[model samples]
Target: MSSAAATLKQQKEDFVSNLSGGPVGEIHAVAFVAPVAVLLWSVLQSRQSFFQRYGLLAFTVDYFLNVVAILLAKTLYSDFPLLLSLLLAVPATLVYVLPPNAVSPKRKPKVPPSADSKNKLDPLPLKPFLTSYRSFMLISTIIAILAVDFRLFPRRFAKVETWGTSLMDLGVGSFVFSAGVVAARPVLKERAEGRSMPWIRRILGSLRHSIPLLVLGIIRLLSVKGLDYAEHVSEYGVHWNFFFTLGLLPPFVAASQAALAFVPSHAALALLISGSYQMLLETTDLKAYILTAPRVDLISMNREGIYSFIGYLAIFLAGQDLGMFVIPRKLNPRSNSSAGVQRNTLIMTLAVWTGVWCGLYALSTNYKYGFALVVSRRLANLPYMLWVAAFNSALVLALCVIDSIFFPAFYNAADPKSEKEAYLTATSRILRAYNRNGLALFLLANLLTGFVNMTMNTLEANPLVTVVILVAYTLAVTSAAVLLDSYNISIRV
Candidate 1:
């Protein structure tokens, strides 16, 4: 073979190798976590003397088996090895272990119904805003650290085409969406109250919630610019930074929400508009211009930055829509019948979302519309949006299932009379810690990443050593968040 052919073959091999941790790969990992967590929860609930006597050993053995499975799969297979492992392990555990011990009489909690119970259809309570916020932060924090310090997997894992990249993209979109949901509540309330505010006033009002974000963004931009920090050119443009995106996002989100008042399904409208713009770029030379333009021109035009912001805005709008759907309009106690109805609604919603996700995935697979068909965070095309929505909906659905099965007592635990409920609150400690100081944790991770780079040769580190370091870094950040939470010092904005 010629040299060119050899190089092409090498690149192809590398790409295939990278598939060890791609989308299917991630699904496999997620698949493993979900079942394992459920199984463990079930065992704990059983409180079986045999299990309690050897529960630690069982957990250790199970975890070891999983790690071995992952390593073997990573070494031997290029595609969906994790999925295969999950397939083998989850069914075995479910059939042989979880089924018999799924429920325990000792674990059941009995509580009186609410006195104010009225309707038979109780609304599902709104998920905490910080759940999404902390989730996004945690994922992004890990990815950001991995990118700079010890890459646990192949470089392709971090490439724009990979599932890991998509995860980060979802994180960003979710964060923006969470904020948009919070900001829109008052605006929605005011509108509902028959208070008519001018469009400009509404926009400004929406932006006020972003003041802390704007300030942080500006500070980060200045620090990065002044210090000549190592930059990921493809993440933003050559001259643009993430802070600029954050700073610009509020106004766009505000504008989009304002438009929502006029256009039903405004999030969908934004998606359509952004998707069209991305298609136009794909079909013409405009994309080339933005990507390859001179720095002066790029900075002045804000070409990629502007387009990406539009995509982000669409994602934020979608998040807002999702928030409105999931969060209850009011928090009132209801009868068991009402709670059952809410649970059924959630199940139905999850089913619908699953179908939607399958359809979108199939469409993207079958149809080729150039770059529009591909998932690109920079472009924020239709496929990417669909993927984000699908993934998030699936996550929420999974949480709902977990809540219903393993920890039903935790729901509405705040009722003073419901003292027999589980000790676990709706918000777990780790989640609460991270949520209370998400921005602080993010900033802390960035600073620590920079420090590590300065102090050690991260690129040259052993992969195992890198993994250890990342674990330490994660623990350190988590500890800080927990400490802050203990003090009730939440660093918002």
Candidate 2:
């Protein structure tokens, strides 16, 4: 490479490195744990016509809640997480406290004609909380991936070098966990219904499903090297990335499918695997080798990624366990499908997730003393897995509480067609859209991130410039996704 090009590349890498990791990711997590619930409760507490669903303001609010909230939290309010959450949530609270018709519905009411089948919106249960939460994780991850490269994002929210919880550190695990949850639709449902399947067939099926991911991983590895991108080797190591890690997990999950029946619980399997992995890390020279070994060979070159596979697998399995718990008892015998989360299941889900979150929190903090093993994204260690489980459960727990407060039924037979009533159910519209083809959206975001990086020098940009670029980037992304959703076009592989 030319001297000037090399110099620019080095400067770019350094500029971004100095901008990452601290308590901000954790603080943001704490701040957001309850606001989504608070917002829903506020909106549902009464017949408030002022804040009509799908109204421009409502869309703005919902859009921010799902797409923009974390972006801004990690950027403008990184230091004032609690305040920002309140700032976003207080309006929702106010909407509830306000009297009905407080803000008059602006649109004229249209009388409903005789029953029209085509215009009907089916009860949108489609695993409401699960899909919505997954979308939230995906959205946050996509936004942060690009934002972290800019000076606008808080350094504190970047991936930590070692053991600690940061927004970026949470991204990989959370993505894997969410993928695992959805990926388990058939596996869990079959288990629930007491069906038998050949273990080899199941493993082969998983391999087939994994082809696209494996291909994508290869593409990413080649593209990064081909372009001579600035890579932080300590994160995933040479030749390994998040894609490969995610891609390899399914086969393992499938291979263990038959063994799942023998195990008392999926959680037990997860614990067994992760616990054993941790033991390997501690009892042998494995941990030191992974962290400190020379990168003379391929295995050593990608020690972080290769070794961390066990940890990611555990996270994925835990997600599947959660999925098994949340899915409706009535499985679709013809296909692996997740519909509306059964209302009857919410109570137990709420309790279990709440308890898990609290238990994990207590254990991780050692009763406020400090983490026994600080969360290490690099190692994907026990603490890291536990943290992912805890945070995701907490997020889901919040959504469950929202569901309990808002929906009288988990899946409504039909939704109100009126524009005003649509607002009430419109909350999940964008989220559902993103969830439909989440991998596509992530891929698009990566491409866009690459384009932006190549086109401009993000590190030297002022905060305002950075914010504007981010907003534009997000708007472009959401708009495309929404457009595709509106057209019923899902780019699913």
Candidate 3:
């Protein structure tokens, strides 16, 4: 490389490394969830005829405001995330729940049919929240992957150097966890219905399914070195990358699917495996080897990725267990469940969230220890696992509330054989698009990240310029999936 180019690459590398990250508090993470909640509320509760006539324009505005605007605002206006949440939430709550003051008394407005009236309609055996969760993770990740290089993105929100919580750190873990949730969906349902696939079949199928990821991992490794990309060596060690971690994980998770007969429960198995791994980190030399060892050989070079895999595996397992609650059970079309069952599910979710937080508190606080174990995304340690679970489950529970309120029939039963769903608004349409074509969308974003980096000096861009580029890049990424979904395209691999 030329001296100037090499120096520029080094400067870019220094920008992202050694970030301390923001404080670990619920208040800040609220920035991430609030806009989404409001967006879904706004779009889903809109009258259907209004959407059919102006759907495209409405979706464009809502998507820009909620998804794109929130993405930029969270970083640019980092000081008052809670305020931002309320700004959107207060208006959304009022608009969705309250009667408009302008209407005359003679004309009665329409409200959704009461749940009592829909007693016979079965809830569609679909989990829109699960899709939304995955899309959120993916969207945050795609935004961060490029946004991190720019000055507009806050350093405090970037991944930490060694051990601490950060939005980017959670983003990675959430991606893995979300992947686990979706991957195990079909198998979990089949097993619940007593048609669990044979162990050998699952292992083989998963491995086959994972080939594209592994290949993409290889391509990423080659491209970084070949292009002399600005890489933070400590993030995943000298040679390892996240794609490799993601690619290698499925077989292990698939094996767990078969081992369910022997293991007591998915949650127990997740905790057991992760706890055992944590013990090894505490007792043996593995932790040191991962943290401080010289990068002389391949294993030492990629120690971070190799050692972190076990923790991620545990996380994926936990997601599978969580999926049992979040993903709807496939009921016979004739089966009619009461609205009470929906309330029961919500109650159970709150209970689960409570337990998750309590476990997280116990681990993080250790009951007045003054200093608890810091979360280590690099090591993917126990505290990190709990933190991921706590963050994700909390969001899931919140989304469930929104889904119940506006999309009440979401948890309603319907014929599994019927048309999947009929979402009216653009935001839901686009989110489902992203979910259907997740991996492809991610790969496209990575490619776009590379292209944008190579073409422009991201480290030097002004705030307005940064936003412009990010918006264009985001539009390109989102539009591709939306366009594909418009044509009935779904790319699995």
Candidate 4:
């Protein structure tokens, strides 16, 4: 190697060594506290006009905090206790510094509805999209994190057997589950409005809608195979990629929905079946067969591409059920009258779900027969599904809480219209940008990852340099998503 190349390589090695231990753990700790910080900022800054005039500025501040946190992890505080304390202190201090709204409530002005209002369906609400946006952003962040935290940085901090790895695996399931939920919502709503379809017809209809995704997956798979990209066989399989999972899983999910339509507690039933399957795998030699099968046919039968899809399907169904439960059944104009009631109901439901999550987590942890929670992305086991569901529910709940507390103030200041009208427009454009073109963003990220890997020596890059690269990659993808959304172009299946 040349003199400059050798120096760069040494720097990379030294940075990787540091990142492998305390720095990486601190980064994870910071990540765990980020949502809280953002929430606190939103609540405390409710009266500020800065967010109203420059919504992108708000997002920028949030992103900047995250970057700073990463830097802090690398430099100032490598210990979890100190880092976490600082994270907690910032939000706690803000709460005391920022006073609650002291302005008197404004009187509502009622407007007589036009004749056309009676015939029109109310606009689709933005609240549901809040969860959708958060999920999409999370998936994007995870993809970025994987590029740096797993691929570029040292492997010691991102070990495959660790809880962090397990959480990332759960995130994969959560991302797909959220997609399934959003896709199923319109169908469920139509059914609720007495436009029900036959189960087989519904299944087939879903498959039809998924045709585009299937085609894209095929194209991607062929491209990867032809290009001979670095394949993570252990992650999925020789022929299976994330895109393939996204494409193929929908049909099975639809089939599950159709088959289980008669069951009142279908989500619970799916969860039960997943647990039983995991138990069977644990007790028998089936896991070995699935993991070590020599032939492609046999391997596909057990790989994350196929059999593990069963658990993912279950997770999807559960997400659909949760979506149905959370979203309002009717979007009639009068539904706005009960917005507070609806918010309270969602909060209550979230609490109940949290209880369920805690119970399951405790049971899984306490079980003595080796039936403990085993989070295996390759297997998509029961515990993993539960964790994903639970975490997602909590996240949605947090967003809703933030919305209930601060969004109204922001909305009122930003718009002159009624609260109901303003609520619909409260969603940030940045979020809408990602939510509208999430698939495109994911595809773009993958393309960028490949491009960057080819152009730069990612595995031998300095940790700080890798972070900068990841941020740049994120910005490029996000900008594309935002720009596409601005043009009203959504790359949907």
Which candidate wins on TM-score? Answer: 3
Candidate 2 colliding pairs, count? 4
lDDT minimum window of 10 residues, candidate 3: 417-426
Error of 2 at 116 (Å): 14
Off by over 4 Å in 1: 1-137, 161-198, 282-284, 298-302, 329-337, 368-372, 410-423
Name the better of 1 and 2 by TM-score: 2
Candidate 3 lDDT at 477 equals 86
Please, what are the lDDT tens digits per residue for candidate 3 over residues 416-438? 22113323322266677788898
Residue-level lDDT of model 4, residues 1-493, one tens digit each, is 4676566555433433321122323433533454454454454445432334345776576444433343333223334535554665576466646655443334222222421234333333336335434544454344534353334433433324312233245447767767756755685568557786676886777776577777877787787666554444555666666766777666666666655556775567667767778877788986776667775585663365676777777777777766666565333334654555656766788778867865675566445853466555577777767766776676667666766666653222322234343442344445556677776677677777767754666665675776677667666765676679667687865
Each candidate's lDDT (Cα)? 0.53, 0.71, 0.71, 0.56
Query: Can you give the TM-score per candidate against the true fold?
Result: 0.72, 0.85, 0.88, 0.78
Runs of candidate 4 exceeding 4 Å displacement: 1-31, 55-59, 62-124, 128-142, 145-165, 296-302, 329-338, 408-421, 424-426
Candidate 2 lDDT over 1-493, as tens digits, reads 8897788788766655532356635654533733463355337433364224456775565566667776777788776777767775777777766665443455533323633335444322245566668877888888888998987787767777766777777777888888777866786556557887788887887887688988999999999999988777878888998888888888899886666678886777888898899888879999999889999999999999999999999999888777766654332334434334445455566577758755764575574574566667889998888878777776777775565565443344444344224333434566767887888999999999999988887887898998889988988888778788767788965
Query: Candidate 1 residues 1-493, lDDT tens each?
Result: 5675455444433432332224643633532343344333333443332233224564344333323333333222224545555655565455545345433446433333543243332233334332533343354434444443333444443335322343345555555655554545555556447797777886787576567666776676677666555445555665565656666766666665556656787456656666676677678986676566666765535666666776677666766665554555332233344545665675677668657765764576455642326566666666666666666666566655655564455343444333223422233445546656766787787788767755765655786776667656655776687679667686755
Clashes of each: 0, 4, 6, 0
| Model 2 weakest 10-residue run by lDDT | 418-427
The deviation in Å at residue 23 for candidate 2 is 3.1
Model 3 has an lDDT value of 0.71
